[model samples]
Target: METDRQGLFRLPFKLPSSAKARSVGVYIAGALYAIGAWSFFDAAIYSRKANASSVHVTFVDWIPFICSTLGMIVVNSIEKNRLIQDAMGSGSFSGSSSMAWQARVILFLGFALLAGGISGSIVVLILKFLVKDFTSYPTLGMGVNNVVGNFCIALSCVVLWIAQNVEDEYSYSLTL
Candidate 1:
């Protein structure tokens, strides 16, 4: 005899099965990146055309966004399989410790740039706008947008990394 047991209710979530469905993460990541980029660009446009305040989005503001973008590119350009193979100690390219070390260093640089971009945006927000008397919403919003945009870009990078395995779907690795 079997008894019907009352259990905790769970939300229904149908997992996607197709490879195309899996790639949706990439699309989402791209959309996030686009939104971030558009936000920053909009800030610049406002500064150029609509801003009443003397403060404007300058090259300093662009620096963080550029760094973040470059970091994203670098981070995603690496092959995750190389790192995995090196750690496992078996693969066609795993024989050379220097290769693994190089990969690690490059990956570290990429992450460092990403972190630096976010921090730099915050620093700009504080030192440039907040510290000054530009407390008005319009002027302050520029700095705030920069910070938000960089953050979104970083988030997009994370999403993209997860979606594409740091963006290398097919790693060229040969096992021995």
Candidate 2:
């Protein structure tokens, strides 16, 4: 008698498995929320500081905090939606088994980190543009720090995105 041979598993490289994407999304959302919260607190503290005028804090610090908080909420919603889609096996996972959902979750987290970093950079840029005449302010160093921080965030996001792609390949190989 002759036996037929079959491949162990089909590779999913075109897009991350839905679960992985969702997990990454949630992680990103959570991180964004944390950052936004921290920013809000920092703004509040700065507003109370004697050196920083209330008007400056309200126009510069509070405005950025509000923007970041709003943006984070949007990110959270996106992540939640992705999670739902993954849970239902709605997108690329349609008709697929749930066996790889965990891996999908991990990938989703990685993506979230990437998204958060990128979003942070954008927020920083907005703040930088909104604030003018740092030299006239007592916190010139702080202003410079913000610029550097934004650059770092953008770089981190790119790195995370690349890592996610590489990680996916490695995970796929392990399963193979």
Candidate 3:
């Protein structure tokens, strides 16, 4: 009777069929980190060429860079966790499945684009307020782009946190 009962319970909730789904978040986080790191390097190079770069890094750049790096670390850690491996031993989160991962990739890209747009608009507003001669240089556009990219990156870190939590909840629910 005990064995029969155990089988009955197992019928409704078996191990996840695959581990493939949970990787969506990992991949998205990895890509964001890569892009942010590349941009940081690019900015450093450009600043060197201009010779106008500040010897002291401003709060703006430093904060976002740190946050993005942390986000990358989190993603890597999640990928390495044993629970995740066990869960996938049955099946992965429905959301992390191959189709779901693809959807997530699209969603991440959309977020990136949205963040870029918002950041660009903000930088333009700042320039309009601070620069008396706004139309003087072509480089102002580049400056604006940089500011916006950083803003987007920082914001994405917050989004990533929320997303990780959501994924955890979703994974738990699937197990039940």
Maximum-lDDT candidate: 1
User: Candidate 2 residues 1-176, lDDT tens each?
Assistant: 73332222234543453556746754664454455455445534554574463243335533433433343333333322233345454444543544455445654565455455445545644555335434544444334333344333334344333223322323443332
Give candidate 2 regions above 4 Å deviation: 1-13, 18-21, 50-56, 71-133, 136-138, 141-176
Which has the higher lDDT value, candidate number 2 or candidate number 3?
Answer: 3
On lDDT, the stronger of 1 and 3 is 1
RMSD per model, one decimal: 8.1, 10.9, 12.9
Scored by Cα lDDT, where does model 3 land? 0.44
Model 3 clash pairs are 16-90, 16-91, 17-90, 17-91, 18-91, 18-92, 21-96, 21-97
**CA shift of 20, model 3, Å:** 2.1
User: Which pairs of residues collide in candidate 2?
Assistant: 19-104, 20-104, 20-105, 20-108, 23-108, 23-109, 24-108, 24-109
lDDT tens digits by residue: candidate 3, 81-114: 3223333445544434554455445445544554
The candidate 2 region of ten consecutive residues with least summed lDDT is 2-11
Q: Name model 3 segments beyond 4 Å from true.
A: 1-18, 50-64, 67-138, 155-159, 166-176
Candidate 3: residue 63 lDDT (0-100): 45
Better of 1 and 2 by lDDT: 1
- In candidate 3, what residue range of length 10 has the lowest lDDT sum? 1-10
Candidate 3: residue 50 Cα off by (Å): 4.8
Q: What are the per-residue Cα lDDT tens digits for candidate 1 across 33-89? A: 998998899899999999987798999999999999999998988776545545554
Error of 2 at 69 (Å): 3.4
Error of 1 at 110 (Å): 0.6
